[model samples]
Target: MNLIKTLIFDFGDVFINLDKEGAMANALEIFEVDTFPEELTHVNCRYEMGLITTKAFLEFYATKFPNLTQGTILHAWNCILRDFPKHRLAFLKKLQAEKKYNLILLSNTNELHIDWIKNEIPFYEEFKSCFNRFYLSHEINLRKPNSNIYEFVLTENNLTPSECLFVDDLKENTDSASKLGINTWNINPETDDVTQLFDVNKRLF
Candidate 1:
């Protein structure tokens, strides 16, 4: 295998653990619904893509569930995010110090998620400093599993798809990158660790 020149990483599940099921339950309870509404999913997509402001997003939820407060809606939305492991940060820092490969963070995250991270994680800045480029979906107006987003990163960074390794927790995201000729690792958060990068994909290194 050819040596990897750049490493593109996903944040949720890969770096920070998420309670996806729990968050879904929380949202259902907050909205008082038996199942997730289709409109809510559309709004969420817009929110993630930065097509809608946080205020507008919250207002949409407020209009749907008038009984719930803004705080409750925000809390339900942020329930998916959990702790950021220190060891992963240490591993990333070491990689940055070595400067062997260009490190990039590409996450399908919104303002509220980032706001929670900044307030909850004491070393949020320190962790971010390790990355050569940090691309949040909301900030970039793009989301994963979409070819345009992957193409944008490759074009912007002047990186060859074959020389870049993309690691994401979602199969669809990894599959999309693989189609672009980028090496990919669809990491399982339950059994895998980002710190095991070199050990897991030794051929690339």
Candidate 2:
């Protein structure tokens, strides 16, 4: 394997555990709908890309579910986010201290989810500090599984794809990176831990 000079990581499921299905169920229950509205999905995409403001995103939901309060909508929307493990933080810190690879965090996250993380996770800043580059989809106006976003990172960093290793919980995101000649690890949070990165991917190291 080629020497890995850079490591790109996904936030959700890779570092922080996400209850995606639970959050979906919570939203459906709060909206009192059997299925998610197509319009809601469209608005969500725009919101994730920062094309819409948080107020506008909430207002759209408020209009759809007249009986639900904004607070309730916000709760359901943020339910996907869960705890960040201490072990992973320690591992990242170790990596940062070593100064071996350029660590980058590239997450498909939005304003609300990030807000929740800021308030809920006391060490959010410390975790972020470990990374050389932090790229949030909403803040960057780019998202995963899209070649442009990956290309932007490569171009901005002057990184060679073959020397970068991307870790993501989503297969699609990793698959996309792989197409560009980057190494990828499709992590399964159920059985995998980010703290075990070096041990798990020993071949790469």
Candidate 3:
């Protein structure tokens, strides 16, 4: 390997543990839906693609389930909020302070998730400041599992694919980046913590 000069990270399972199933169950219960509705799934896809605004998303769900209040829907949507371990943040910060490889965060997230992070995680602002660059799928209108997204980051940052390493929880996303020549680490948050990847200080110099 080229002794990676840039580190690209995924947000959801990679940084924080997301309660996807829990959130969906809550949403289903609040709406009295039998299973994950197609509309709900489609709306989420749109949300992930940044095609719809958060307010619009809430309204859409509210409209679908007229009996549900905006607050209830919001709560269900935000049920996925989980903790971002301070140790992980601390490790990344150490790399930042040491002027390590350019660090970037690329996440496929939505408005509800963003809102939850701001309100729930007290260190959200501090955590974000550690990255050299941040790219949210919803904000960028592009998402992983798509090669173009990987290309966009490479082209925009003027980074060579061979010089960067990407860490993601999803295999599909890693496949896309790999096709573009970016080295990848398919990390399982349940089993692997990112700090074990490399010596932060050593990687920098």
Candidate 4:
């Protein structure tokens, strides 16, 4: 706890509530797919990493699912995002005010989703202001569960992995960071909240 000088957080399911299951169900129903095919998955990955423009990304979907309207595609894409709790912002602001540790926000998000958030969440800029560094997978072209993304954060910030605590909802992502000697908390979004960070990870905090 004492050694941790940096706190790395995942945005989705950490600060912002995401209806992943519901969104997936919606997408499946809308797209008429039992599961996303590899091509769609690959294109999604590329879009997240900013390998393609939003126009191109939307065009891909439109080309494939011509019957579906653009609004429907956009709706299904952004549906995963839900309300962001203000208590989490309060906690983060307090942490920032204390100047006790470096705060960083890391998330695998694409342009449309971020655009939607910025437009929807009135306090989006305020929330972003709390972090020393904010890395979006689309902006950085590096998604987590991939070790290099963690490595890039460590290198770019000149942070010692052992001195940093990375919190994410996914085990695979935390595991990747953990392998680099970073302290991690694989939080279950259903049962945990970032506001309880210090209390939840007593050993680390």
- Per-residue lDDT of 74-188 in model 4, one digit per residue for the tens? 9989999999999999999999999999999999999999999999999999999999999999999999889999999999999999899999999999999999999999999
Q: Model 2: per-residue lDDT, tens digit, 45-154? A: 88999999999998988898888888898889999999998888998999999999999999988999999999999999999999999999999999888999999999
Superior by TM-score: candidate 1 or candidate 2: 1
Q: Estimate TM-scores for all models.
A: 0.97, 0.96, 0.90, 0.98
What lDDT is obtained when candidate 4 is compared to the true structure? 0.94
Tens digits of per-residue lDDT, candidate 1, 5-95, equal 9999999999899999999988887787899989889999989999999999999988988898888888899989999999998899899
lDDT for 165 (candidate 1)? 95
Model 1: lowest-lDDT 10 consecutive positions: 24-33
Off by over 4 Å in 2: none
In order, the Cα lDDT scores of the candidates are: 0.93, 0.92, 0.85, 0.94
CA lDDT, candidate 3, residue 132 = 89
**Candidate 1 lDDT score relative to the true structure:** 0.93
lDDT of 1 at 128: 93
Question: What TM-score number comes out for model 1?
Answer: 0.97
Ordered by lDDT, highest first, the candidates read 4, 1, 2, 3
